[model samples]
Target: MENISLVIMEKEKDTGFLSRELGSYEVKYDTEYVSSIYASREDENLYVNMYLTVPGEFEDWKYNAILDNYDTGLYKDKALLAEEDEDSYNPGWVIKFLFLENDNEMEEKINELLGIHVSELERVLSQLKNIEDEYRD
Candidate 1:
C-alpha cells in the first residue's frame, strides 16, 4: 500500500505576500519534477523529505526549467531551492507535507483537494519515515 504523491510547489519568497497566500500555486507545481527525496523517522512516527526545483529561475546554469510566475512574487532571474536530504539534488522552496500513518487519510484529503488518485503518497510517507529514522535515531 503506497500513499506517496509528488507535487511541484513554489514560494513567493515572502517579498510582499500574505501568510495565508503561500500555498496557493496549486496547478503549476503539479508537473515535471526537477528533483525529489524521502526519508522516515526512527519509530516510523515521523517523516521528512525535500522538494527541489528551479521554477521560473531561467539561467544558463542550474538547467533551464520554465515555471509559471502568474501571481507569484518570485522571478526567473533568482532561484528558489533547498538542500535537506544531502543525498538527492537541491529542492525548491516549497516543502510538501508528509505525515506518518498508513490509514490513507491524508491521501483522501489530498484527492479531495487536488482531485487525483495518488497512491504514491503512501510511498513517500514510508520513505520519509525510513529516512527520518536514520537521522533522528
Candidate 2:
C-alpha cells in the first residue's frame, strides 16, 4: 500500500469518473500525454524514471526508445508535451535516490532509456545541493 497521492502519482494520471485525467499537472483542454514519475535503484545506484505520454494517445513512450529513431524519440525533449502546452511544463521533480555509489550507472540507464547520451542529471544535482544546504543551516 501507498499514500493516496502516491498511488495516484503512480497512475498515468489520476482519472475522474468522467475519464478526465486531473491533477496539479492535469492535461486538460488542448494537451498531449500524461506523465509518470518513479524512483529506481540498482545496488548502490539510484535514479528516477519519468514516463511521458505519447502525443495524441496519452500512451507510454517506451516503444520509441530506439537510437535509430532518435528523430522520433519520445524522450528527445525529456517530456515535452505539445507546441500548445509548452508553458505548462514546470520541470517537475521526484526524489529518486538516497545514495548512488556508481554515479555513471544512472546516466547510462537514462541514456539507454531515452535513446540519447546524457552526461549528467543537472537538475537533480542542483536540487540535491539545495537540499544539503538546507540541512546545513
Candidate 3:
C-alpha cells in the first residue's frame, strides 16, 4: 500500500479555495510554476510542504535566505542590481512535517509552517475534504 498521498495546491489557481487559510510569501523574479502548498498523508501522519521560489536571476536567493534571514532583505532593492544569468530556478521551504498523530498534531504543524492560527488551520483542513481522492500519489 502507498503510505503517502499528496495534493499540490497552487496559490494562483487555488486562491478561491486556499487564499484565506493558506498564506504565501513575496519573492522577486518568481515564476508561477512553483507549488504553493502540498498537503499529504503518510500512513497516519499528516504533512504539509510549503514551497517557495525566486526569479531565475535570483536563483540562489532562496538558499541564502534559508541560511540567513538577512539575505532576504536583498529583495527590497533587487531591481537595482544587475541581472544575473538564468541557469535554473530552485524551490524553497518553510517547514516539512513528516508525520502527524491526529487532528491536533495536524493543526499544530500547519500553524507552524503557514504562520496561521489554529482556527485557520481548522478551516484549511475542512476545505481539503472537498478535494477528491484521485489526487493521491
Candidate 4:
C-alpha cells in the first residue's frame, strides 16, 4: 500500500456567496490514483474532496465493484461518490466526505480518513493483481 499524506498548500476564507474556509492540498502518494485534493469547512462540517484516476483500462464491473465496496463499507454514511463522467478527456472519480468538526481530534480524524482511502486502494490493487496472476497461469 502506498503512503498517503495530505500536504496543505494554501488556505483562506472565502467571503463570497457561500462563505467558507477553503483549502487546497497536495496528495502525496506512491501511485497515480489521486490527482487532486480540496477541502472546505463551513460551520461544523468539513468537506474533503478527492479526485482519483485509475491507470490502464478498467472494466465497468471492476469499477462498479469498487463503488459497491465503498457503499457498503464504514464510510458508507459519510462519503458520497460523484457520478462518473465518461465524456471527459481525463476521466476520473470524485469522492467527497463530510466530517463533523471535533476541535480536539480534528487532525486524528483527517488521518483516519486518509487511512480508509488507502485501505480501499490496497484492496482494489490486490484484486487486480490476483486477476492478472490468474491470466498468467
What are the lDDT figures for the candidates, one per model? 0.32, 0.30, 0.36, 0.51
Once superposed on the true structure, which residue ranges of model 1 sit more than 4 Å away at CA?
1-31, 42-44, 55-57, 60-91, 94-98, 108-137
Please give, for residues 11-86, the per-residue lDDT of candidate 4 as tens digits. 2347323344343222334435556655666576566656655555655555554554442255555466453434
Model 4: CA > 4 A from native: 1-33, 40-46, 53-74, 80-92, 99-104, 129-137
Residue 26, model 3: Cα distance from true site in angstroms: 14
lDDT of 2 by residue, 29-94 (tens): 222222444444445543343443333221122222211122323344443221222222332222
Ranking by lDDT: 4, 3, 1, 2
Question: Per-residue lDDT tens digits of candidate 1, residues 1-137?
Answer: 33334432322233422222112122323433335433333343333233444334323222211121111232122212222323433323333345424435533433432222122232333354335434343
State which candidate has the highest lDDT: 4
Clashes per candidate, residues 3 or more apart or on different chains? 30, 0, 3, 0
Distance from true location, Cα of 14 in model 1, Å: 35
The lDDT, on a scale of 0 to 1, for candidate 3 is 0.36
Over 1-137, each residue of candidate 3 has an lDDT whose tens digit, in order, gives 22222234422333435432332333222233233555454455444554433323332433333233312233233111212223324423233445443545554444433332222324433544343242332
- Model 3 pairs whose backbones collide: 29-55, 45-100, 46-100
* Better structure of 3 and 4 per TM-score: 4
